[model samples]
Target chain A: MYLLLDQPTISQSSGNVVDGINLEDIKEFAKAFKLRRLGLGLTQTQVGQALSVTEGPAYSQSAICSALASQMLAAQLSSQQQNIFEKLDITPKSAQKIKPVLERWMKEAEERYASGQNHLTDFIGMEPSKKRKRRTSFTPQALELLNAHFERNTHPSGTEITGLAHQLGYEREVIRIWFCNKRQALKNTVRMMSKGMV
Target chain B: MYLLLDQPTISQSSGNVVDGINLEDIKEFAKAFKLRRLGLGLTQTQVGQALSVTEGPAYSQSAICSALASQMLAAQLSSQQQNIFEKLDITPKSAQKIKPVLERWMKEAEERYASGQNHLTDFIGMEPSKKRKRRTSFTPQALELLNAHFERNTHPSGTEITGLAHQLGYEREVIRIWFCNKRQALKNTVRMMSKGMV
Candidate 1:
């Protein structure tokens, strides 16, 4: 079931609230997410760049990872080819053993959402990396291309990048870079827009 | 062009830099956005909520608005929905216009971006007012009906709520409430998703 958090004055301790979050947990979650967004070079404003600018109404700095977020927005802004399963939300004890399970998990999530279970809640006790190291150089052009591609693909029938590349008069490799950078860029942008990743 | 903010740390400047942000005019620009988002009852995280969680990344708390200083986050996130007519790095008066100019600015920005300009040099400005209060109330049946209609409408030629409500034996008022509530629910969901809000 989806949650409603309209009341801003969230009680720190009600004693009876189920699955309720506490101030201490809030602080811990906040710190980790903050470090990740910044360490990953994402700012909250940038994360919502695609959503507010491209898809829907604007949101605040928080609300990045809650499964109860916008379904349409998620579908609209996601990196089509970038599997959500690969996101570092859940950890696997062994990559080999968990590969199939991971794939199934993706399928299930997609189906569940499609079947109208908009809010997802299982994370399998996954852990994010303490320090992630992604070393790559990307340009703005690359980001634009990928963003365009993801947006287009979210539609029923996808478009061809070859024609797009030809129109833009750039190399295919450049276009590929654009998609790669675009996904990362979107991720950073999404995170920033969601939680306030400083 | 788009900018790739490098992970490389820039040495803090004792002589000119205002805590990594050059304040001269940016401060006023920041203030304008602060007033805008807050006036709208938006926290920083709420401003960035539309982007990624609109898609479906997991939730994070701290990292959501972590990368942006409150001022900058407020400025950029507040203006994410609107377009900018000036450079973000310019005088606050120039940057402060980002909020009001957003919608028109976004179209222009898209055009300019398509033509060759990948980066927006300025953050947009806006005028926010608590007077522009959003409607967030909905009856449960209305919400259920609207969501049901949404599911149907997702198909190629999905049904509209009016038609669905008729089929579901509900009145037009009920359907309208459902739609209103659904919209708010979606927006609220996005709000929560940003920085993994409530």
Candidate 2:
């Protein structure tokens, strides 16, 4: 169980982060800490001990989940630690990386909770019934074969693609989707270049 | 093999990133992308396709490696990206997640080399040679069991250690080191907090 520490507000002051950090950045990290722990498959109690909170009770799953969703949608609801940034008004500059930032913040929050912090809550903005899309995971060997084939032919054709799939003993569609995702990822990276999106 | 986009000066004279991005961040991402690809088990050409770079004539294994190492380390070396207010000029704060970050960087560098980027040839002034450590990656469940056990009785004496190990079906030393690393992680996190080490 996660220990929710009652945070005392510092200043909600804004300043450029020293060493690439600021309160905004820290807030962003708080979101991430929670998310990463969740992603790491740790329950709140496990997270609490990992962080070392000896005083408080372990976090209930709902409380942890709510804190993640709520904080992402809005800031800390209560006055305790209200010094967090202007709640959840994610700026235009943030890209998809915004979600990862929130996840990181959750990781930090988990860390805080472990230190005997009081119960903090967050609500997921999405419907409880909603399900996230499962991302495609690639295997190292499969990727190598594809890379090798690509290096052999600067611009491969559909036949070539199918042939390689046959050679690799896989269906053509998987190769097709891989190409599609790769293309999209590149586009995003290049776009970041154009927009100077960090 | 990886495609070598014509060598883009990470930035022209003004040093503003080609996009609004800090060059280091993109470079960092490029490395991460390479790692993700490597983790996927893909070769340079495969990664090229994913990024939508044409494979074959322009792409080469060596180039891929160059991009991987250069992009990852450039940020670390960049005074601009390092930190705006690092009074002590120590490691970057982003450097906080050292193990995972460095591991990811290494994986990417391998991919870049396979793709034929020659940029790593002159990376002389960067980080110190890494000291190798032997630590096995633990399954999440195992880590949980260890963390939970520690919470109840932190410094278990000999029989307690053996008993806990016997109960959990773990080696006494594994439990021992889990506590060690757990303590270390907490100390570092707290140290980061006190030093404004975000």
Candidate 3:
């Protein structure tokens, strides 16, 4: 399902399209999402901050921008590329991922505004986020060991993960997630290298 | 920021409006998301199937539909409620959540199509999803006990949760998640009651 969208276009908006994806639809959504964000009187930075403190993992402004639009290669685009979807800097998949989070947040914010509670605190739930474990700051030495373990084998058994957790004074689940994220990171890195961008 | 958007409108589309959310934008995007999905020759059912087998939690057909449109009460709409934005049934927050997951899956599927690997197998990814954990089916006795505990205290300390896990022979995390989901369900139920639906 991984479509290598980094490459420039081959000009086939019709007939046996690559990925069977409708670029036109993706383009429209991206433009609309941006407009909606603006209409909410919220900036990308503000959305980014609000999302980070809510629930789930934090997303950066760059991530948000990528979901909405990517920087297309100048050669491929027209001199006056007004539409965000003209070149489709961002992929359809990334946009799909981000749209809902932004949508829901904006809706909630608007509701608060409508109710006459136009405060940022009211937008982000007043109750602090549930205590999902605090962000673990891995020391250099710990990272080295973890990296070495990962290099040896990405998929460590529960027992092995538990042993490592005991040794490093971290939770077993944390170590497990670390391995998962590390493998994902490695996979992304390898993919980048293959694309000759590394 | 929980914004109850079920009520009738306050009507302030211009000039420093509260509830600054643009339903028009959300409606357009929802329509666009559907078109893109159709262009890819994928059904909502197919997408739901594909999402279930993937990394994240499974999404239902209702979830998919709600992402695009929800069943709004007749009273909520005007006589000529042609536009989807007229008293949106689905909340923006929920739509935001589902968008990215769908977007990502569709892109992957389209990529598969472009590469001439236009099969469900190819679209769902080559390797099987990593086995994180299976869904636990709690016994009737366990459910009764758990419900009893929940009635007493909606919030259980980690130690208490661990104790329950050991007592019920279930994973601590599963028990914790159950509590979280239960609380959410309860909150949703309360909201529905407030809206005079139940």
Q: Give each model's whole-structure lDDT.
A: 0.35, 0.42, 0.51
**Candidates' chain B TM-scores in the order shown:** 0.24, 0.29, 0.41
| TM-score list, all predictions | 0.23, 0.22, 0.27
Q: Candidate 1: where is the Cα deviation over 4 Å?
A: A1-198, B1-25, B32-159, B165-198
Name the candidate, 2 or 3, with the larger TM-score value: 3
Writing each residue's lDDT as its tens digit, candidate 3 over B28-110 gives 44455567667766667666666666644455565455434431121122323323222223233333344355456666666
Query: What TM value does chain B of candidate 2 have?
Result: 0.29
Task: Flag regions of model 3 displaced more than 4 Å.
Answer: A1-198, B1-108, B111-126, B129-135
Worst 10 residues of 3 chain A by lDDT: A1-10
lDDT order, best first, reads: 3, 2, 1
Candidate 1 on A1-198: residue-level lDDT in tens?
Answer: 111111243545433211232333332333333344333233333332222222232221112322123321232233462243232121122212222322343344445544643222221111132322222333466456644455444211223565554434333444555555433443443333333222
| Candidates' chain A TM-scores | 0.22, 0.29, 0.40
Lowest-lDDT window of 10 residues in candidate 2 chain A?
Answer: A83-92
lDDT (Cα, tens digit) per residue for candidate 3, span A1-198: 001121233444433112454444444444455555545544444455466556344343223543344421211234364343332233445445665666566666666655654344445422354655434557577788986676456678999998887566455677899988755543442322232211
Top-DockQ structure, candidate number: 1
Residue B23 Cα positional deviation in candidate 2, in Å, after optimal superposition: 33
